[model samples]
Target: MTELREAAPSAGTDLLDERTRELADYCAAMTGRLRVIGQRLDRDPDAITEFLHEPQVRFPVQGMLPPQYRSAGEFPAPLVAASSTVLGQVVATEQVAYGDPNVILASPGPSLSGGVVQALADEQQRQRYFGRLAAAPTHTFFALTEPAKGSAALELETTLTPAPGGGWLLNGAKCYIGNGARAQLGVVFCRRAPGPWGIEAVLLDTSAPGFSGELLPTVGLRGARISRLRFQDVAVAPEDLLGADRSPSRRGLYGATYILYRFRPGIAAMALGCAQAACDYLRTHRATLPRQDRHRLDGVLDRIAAVRHRTYAVAAAVDAGVVDVAGIGAVKARAARVAEDATRLVAELLGPASLIEHPWLEKTYRDVRAFELMEGTTNLHTMAAFQSLLRSRTALQPAAQRAVDGAARH
Candidate 1:
């Protein structure tokens, strides 16, 4: 938050700054490519399972990195702006998902993975990896979540032991990795030893020996090649360690947490997209509904607007260096619930036609549900946000009090 305050304007009027405008323009231009992907997904529900292998399709999404990540000449504003643009991309994808839900999955991997690189990597490492993205399309994954631990990232059982020769020997598995199956490189979080400070991160070449993955079947976001990655004695040089000398300490955890804080708002925006699309469709098609139903529709639209504006406010806070980890969780948890509620409301408006016609509504309804589960589950985040609010002395403040109440039972 300290960094953002110096970089961005205070959270007030004029939320749609140059950065948001640039993101909107970029998304508008990329809509056609996304539409084409959605069309392909419509023909084949599991099309995202194999879509990553195609250079033509993959490169376009990756190529968007240059515009999205362009420097903003400040500390956290650049990060905040890039994250804001990511939200725009997610919105675009959700808009596309109105036609085919699978298409939204492809673009999120790069944004999620890129955040890891930006947060943990040294200048040399950043230039080396991100430069490839600027020159051409490149895919990367953030490997932290595990099957046994789920959202408890610090509880990871993945081990990185000293190699017999020199570097390191990695042996463990990561599940639900966004780009795990097809990424050229990945940021793998591992326990350097048997304690909290032992938590460390490494940037590993996914093509290295003993590294492999298989796509996992998913109910939604079928276009994403989400997989469980196995690292069986995957060898890495000392240079592959992330954060220069910052590993094997709480620094790694802080860095990773920072990355998550920045990206969660974008996930909120993805949910916003789902909600927005649903609201727009409902407004247009549900006009002849009963008076009571129309009143409910107005409530839904108003709620959507509130969540959308709150998400933008979070982005502004991120730029201003004022948002905390709990704040991120609060925004995302609220947005996820809002999006789910909006989609469900739209479905109910169909009044049985939902089961037959409006395939777009049906897919988005399912797709939006995944938002509650992704990044972190709604219950986990809600509980975390509530706990944080309880501990904050600022809880007496009106805004902080509202946040606490919002996260509870929502």
Candidate 2:
């Protein structure tokens, strides 16, 4: 038993090592793509998409995440790192990499590569698809929340009806969809037939007929390239029915849940990154500012570090599989809270400069604000974590009963 326990960690470590290497490879690929994109920053979207189709930039759609951990304990550190790196590169080049905003969105369906096929125990296919998606800048979106339905999955009004030829027809409008305006492909969750259990995942080709996108003007995160998407009887091939054909199998649900779970850590990472950016900006500008604000700036920095540490710790725990979904949700909520607080603190410390367009603090502030809304909103996650803890407490009763029964037997 002791040996088994000890070996478990080794196994996990090995898995982590393998994933790290894959991520490193992805990072290298992304670096090459960004170099190419750099030259075409001023080019139109069609040119950019064409540039992405290059062999060096194209990656397979599979192997993006460990299947078991994809929705549960996987940190998706590679994807998050790639995103941060890409964001930094785009910002540095004075261009927005809005090719696929859905890559950052936490919906579970296909990997970031916009592959139409779903994971169904096909390791080779998964790896191939993951590699392809990771290598290129494919804009993807989570078209779940609608203006009418909000975050209520059961209230989703988007419909996916079966066509005569095994294909599906999608009709709905997605609002405030990240990457919607520029995404080539997206994973859209729609009510196949509205009822108690009607939600199904479907992959949509954004460039297909009857699909259109309009940019939404927003006060914050203006550069995020958010837009509203309209699908009017959009024709989808049979291959795009990602997990929608099943009779709601447990495995399918688990796969979906796993994807949602993985996003918690990613959302937390985004928050941490935004908070760090804010704090870094404050630090860089402290010396140039008035002496009176130095002490306040220092305090903000300390708070930011503390918040960042907690976020990293939670992220590490999720990656290590030490935390379950509820724990991850709690951690995500906490990370967002800390990020929000830290951003506000830094903004306060920076005063007028924090709001200026020249400084990244403003961008950080806006981006961090979005983190609070992403994955699961802080309030919703808190409620979910509390409910999960309650369920766990109830589940402990049986274990306690077994212990008592064993004692009596003795």
Candidate 3:
């Protein structure tokens, strides 16, 4: 929560600030390139490497790096500032995702791993890796999902045992790791002993001996290159362990929690963007449709606006030192459902064959689905929201009883 409060909101009456608006305009310009290469990348996931030089692919990646690590000249103040903050990223991601979520998802950058880096990496670790990323366009993955269990603390089977000579040996298999196969460097989470406190994170090099990553089959977001990684006694240097010098309590699973808090807004924005794209597409193609369908589209658009504002508000709250996990969870879950519903409604409105007829819409229909699986599942979020509801009921009891007592006296 302390780290969450670090990003102060820039001065603005509107939800978006001037810098955020500038970044949005810049992202809007890059949409054409993403639209162009999206299909190609879908057909061949490896094609992501070919477009590294493109602004859409290059800028967002550069935008995520802090000013100090940015090797690129003068970290364009607008996008660069937005790049570091939750609210800034929320504005940028929604716009970029409008064109194609795959463009940002598949691009080589810190991305999902950046939050973890910020949450845990020490000065030396940050300088060593972020510096390398700044110097070149390198794909990165945040390895948490595992072969058997999907990041369940107790069920996690990955191990980081001490090596015979020194340091540690990483042995595990991670599934559903985006950019895992192609990534030259990234972070991996594993357990050194048992229980939650056993968890430890390490800076991982794809080239390390016994480390292997392979692309997994994906129906949607084919360009995302969701992959599987295997580590068989892969050696980890002492310096590679994140927060190793800290006490066991400080080095536990909270860092992972912090990363989730940091990125939930951006995740919601991705879904919102996808939903908006579908709605806009349907409006353009089916404007002459009967009044009923037009009204339905209007309702959908309204929902997007309401949810967009909610997403922005939650992001601003986090920036202002209020990390309302319940609100955030509800927003992320609702955004995802809205995205799915938008695509479904648009498909019906656009005609039965629209999915087959329109290539981009079809890709979008497939792409929006991947968001539900990102960060956390919708079910998990809804339950968190429900838990908050129960807590709120208890929290209001004292005031509620005082009001009742005053009425009784009267």
Candidate 2 vs. true structure, TM-score: 0.65
Candidate number with greatest TM-score? 3
Q: Could you give me the TM-score of model 1 versus the true structure? A: 0.79
* lDDT tens digits, residue span 201-248, model 1: 888777899999988877666556679999999997888877756644
Off by over 4 Å in 2: 1-137, 164-166, 194-197, 244-247, 250-255, 287-323, 352-354, 397-410
TM-score of each model, in listed order: 0.79, 0.65, 0.92
The top-ranked prediction according to lDDT is 3
Pairs clashing within candidate 1? 1-321, 1-322, 4-320, 4-321, 5-320, 5-321, 48-223
> What are the root-mean-square deviations of the candidates from the true structure over C-alphas?
8.7, 10.1, 5.5
lDDT against the true structure, per candidate, is 0.66, 0.52, 0.80
Ordered list by TM-score, greatest first: 3, 1, 2
Q: Considering lDDT, which of the candidate structures 1 and 3 is the better prediction for this target?
A: 3
Taking the tens digit of each residue's C-alpha lDDT, what string does model 3 give over 308-387? Answer: 88898889888888999988988898899899999999888878898899878888889888888887898888888989
Worst 10 residues of 2 by lDDT: 1-10
User: What value does the lDDT take at residue 292 in candidate 3?
Assistant: 82
Candidate 3 has what TM-score? 0.92
Question: What shift in Å separates residue 303 of candidate 1 from its native position after superposition?
Answer: 1.3
